[model samples]
Target: MHGEQMAEEFPVVGLDTDAREAAELLASQRLPGLIVADENGAPYTVLPASQVVRFLVPSYVQDDPSLARVIDESLADQVADKLAGVSVRALLPKELAELPVVNHDDTVLEIAAIMARLRCPLVAVVKDRKIIGAVSASRLLEVAMTPH
Candidate 1:
């Protein structure tokens, strides 16, 4: 199937949007993920809520007062702090193969192959070499169920 036909309306968050807001939006929308856009409305990074959780939750496992204090903070503050020292670029997958994306006319089989090969939950669908929407793994499965 073509990427345009396979593409579904995907949620987006601006770079200026705080991580907490982004996290909350993800939860509220029940989306598989969100596409982070730049100031010019260009796709920058695709962030999963799982990654947001990872960014917020402390990595250490201890019973120290300092750690406890840190963990007791609000989600917004916690997310802001995490983002203070980080950028969207840092969260991107190291290899392009790991960052699944498809052109507007790409077939469903091609998308499925990329998703499987890259272990991505969704693949961005590009129109005119720009991200317009995404095709989730579930969506791909739905299409595959129908005989061509």
Candidate 2:
């Protein structure tokens, strides 16, 4: 399937969404990520589930895996506490990487390249300055592996 076809299966979120809410949506929907839109509802960025997890964990813990052992398992249940009042934009890299986006008519190959370069599980598909949908890495793989 092409990008627009694949995008129909995914969901979108706004840039102002709370980090904790986004995380919960990712978990509950079993999605790789969500398409983030600007106030105008134009596709802006891709927020991957991995990024959310990285945001929840302290940088020191991420830099040193051994430090994770010091925290009790119960800490996992308190992720919301750590993410309280944090917006999705705050969790994004401060350097401001370009948001990965593809046209609705873009080929699977193009979508794959964007996902690879961005290191994100999904890419936003847009038309007329609005998000049409999202193309997920897994969906691309499924199309690739299917018999032609």
Candidate 3:
């Protein structure tokens, strides 16, 4: 199987997209992550749901997870506020993860390797320098586990 063969249309966000909206999308769709496109519409980076959740947690809690146990439910409900008025770019870590990309004709094994090496849930499949679609980790696993 090839990348395009299994590729599914996936959501793509921009660096300047509202963080709250992005979070809402993730929550509503249960997406593992988003493909963030650059100004030229090429893959810039991935915005994983885990990263957003990490950003929501207060630094103090991250420093000492024990503090999380102390936080009350009321404050927990306001965690989404942290994302208010922020852009996706601001949510990115200081050092970005490698862009998980594959050619349209890349083999399934190739796609799997890129996903495993990057620890990403999605891989953007590009053709002629433009993103056409994406092959998700679950889709790859499905193909791998299924007998031809």
Candidate 4:
């Protein structure tokens, strides 16, 4: 399958979108991640579910899993407060490893390679420098496992 065939339309979020709002969208949509678009609605970067979790959970909790056991219902709200004013861009690492991108006509194998290299959950499919859709890593695996 080609990228265009495998690509699934996902919601795009702006760089300035609040982390909490982005998290809500991901949860409500049951999406693996969301595409971060530039001012021109062009693909810029990806915000994977793992990245979101990392941003939400405190570092101490991540360092010691046992700390998570002490998190009560009330404390959960406090945890969410951390994301109140945080933007999507602020959650991203300063150095980007790669931007998983593929042309609409790219083969599934090609897309898979890019995704693997970048360790991204989704890859943007572009046509004429504009994002047309995206293919999740799960979709790429589905295509790979199918006997074409």
Would you list the C-alpha lDDT of every candidate in the order shown?
0.72, 0.81, 0.91, 0.87
- Candidate order by TM-score, decreasing, is 3, 4, 2, 1
Between candidates 1 and 4, the one scoring higher on TM-score is: 4
Clashes in predicted model 2: 0
- Residue pairs in candidate 1 whose N, alpha carbon or C atoms collide under 3 angstroms: 1-107, 1-108
Worst 10 residues of 2 by lDDT: 1-10
**Can you give the lDDT of residue 131 in candidate 3?**
89
Best by TM-score: 3
lDDT of 1 by residue, 49-101 (tens): 66666655555623343665656446546554665545554554464344567
Clashing pairs in 4: none
Q: Which scores greater on TM-score, model 2 or model 3?
A: 3
Off by over 4 Å in 1: 62-98
lDDT of candidate model 1 versus the reference:
0.72
Which lDDT tens digits does candidate 4 get at residues 26-143?
8898898999998888888988888888988889989998988888979876876888888999888788767777999999879988988888889999999989899998888888
Candidate 3 contains a number of clashing pairs equal to: 0
User: Quick one: RMSD of model 3?
Assistant: 0.9
Q: Candidate 2 — which residues are off by over 4 angstroms?
A: none
- Supply the TM-score for candidate 3: 0.96
